[model samples]
Target: MPENDRLRNIRKETLSSAWYTLYRYDFEYRRSDGRWESRQREVYDRGNGAAVLLYDASRRKVLLTRQFRMPTFVNHNPDGLLTEVCAGLLDGADPEAAIRKEILEETGYRVEQLEKILEAYSSPGAVTEILHYYLAAYHPGQKEAEGGGVPEETEDIELLEFGFEEILEKVRNGEIRDAKTLILIQYAALFGPLRPVAREIQ
Candidate 1:
């Protein structure tokens, strides 16, 4: 089917700047059969844009950043530490390129090749952010760059390299508390035909 014949019309688009930090919007549409639908989303409304989380398959490990999240601090935990994949807002660059750059900056591990595995909304009903997840294979080595996050961003980040089994344990224990991280870890665990249970100590 051609693009024009695929759908009927977009009924509405509501765009707004949120909390003076994020950009959020929604769209309402009508399909050919007169069905109405809507979706709410955000795209780096705070100028961060799109982001990628990478899994290094060759090393059987994942790269994550441990940083303080303000919201988490205010609402859930005081420390607000988040263990997440290398991610950043798009800043108008290509998503794949962004992932590669983020991997280098955050973990000091350069990724030569990246394979996109999934793209999903952070939270459609509330936040407009979409995440692009990827899997890249890399050999374990030293920091290829300065070794940590860009200081100006107040990102006192620590790089963590963990094998797949180790990471799944954290997830199962609720230690890897970030939503995106959880989703990506589960996706990688199920990458093959047989989805095995994550290894976690009881």
Candidate 2:
């Protein structure tokens, strides 16, 4: 341990089965200084891994999915249909590989190039999920399947493509409501225009 390092204490932890699609867990910890703490952490507990939010640069648009989320249903919406970028948990795969796989699985959109934008924790205070956001470019003929998502996973998904104005409208109309999606969209709005050109002919 380093001299400047701080000590953290955990007093208790409990995990429930991942009913539906969400991981359920409870935790309590106490610090070395005698302070006590408690929290509920979500994730497989095998490990915390990477996720990605994919963006399309040339279209000046983003691809998102509308799927039912259990947590959202519990909180407010029984419908719980959420609009989110192509994303998936990285069990052990590299972030880029995970993004590519998820893109294929979720949207059936193939990419020729992919670039990393940022890596961040989904929520530091409780959960142990991290996201590696990415941007990629795809051509018109690349979209393949209906891409409704996996059925064994119980996913009922609708693929959607949104222009900048459309997403801004969604945001203004309170349609785009997920936190991670909000963050990624805002990041794109402020910085998307700066993305490098795919075709630079000499």
Structural similarity to truth (TM-score) of each candidate: 0.71, 0.74
CA lDDT, candidate 2, residue 103: 80
Worst 10 residues of 1 by lDDT: 192-201
lDDT of 1 by residue, 1-202 (tens): 1224333333333355455344444555566687767755554444333344455555666667888889889987878887787788776788888877777777777867677877888766655567787766666664478647778867778977787677777877788877877777777677721134342322
lDDT of 1: 0.66
Candidate 1, residue 167: Cα displacement in angstroms equals 1.3
With candidate 1 superimposed using the best TM-score fit, by how many Å does residue 109's alpha carbon deviate from the native?
1.7
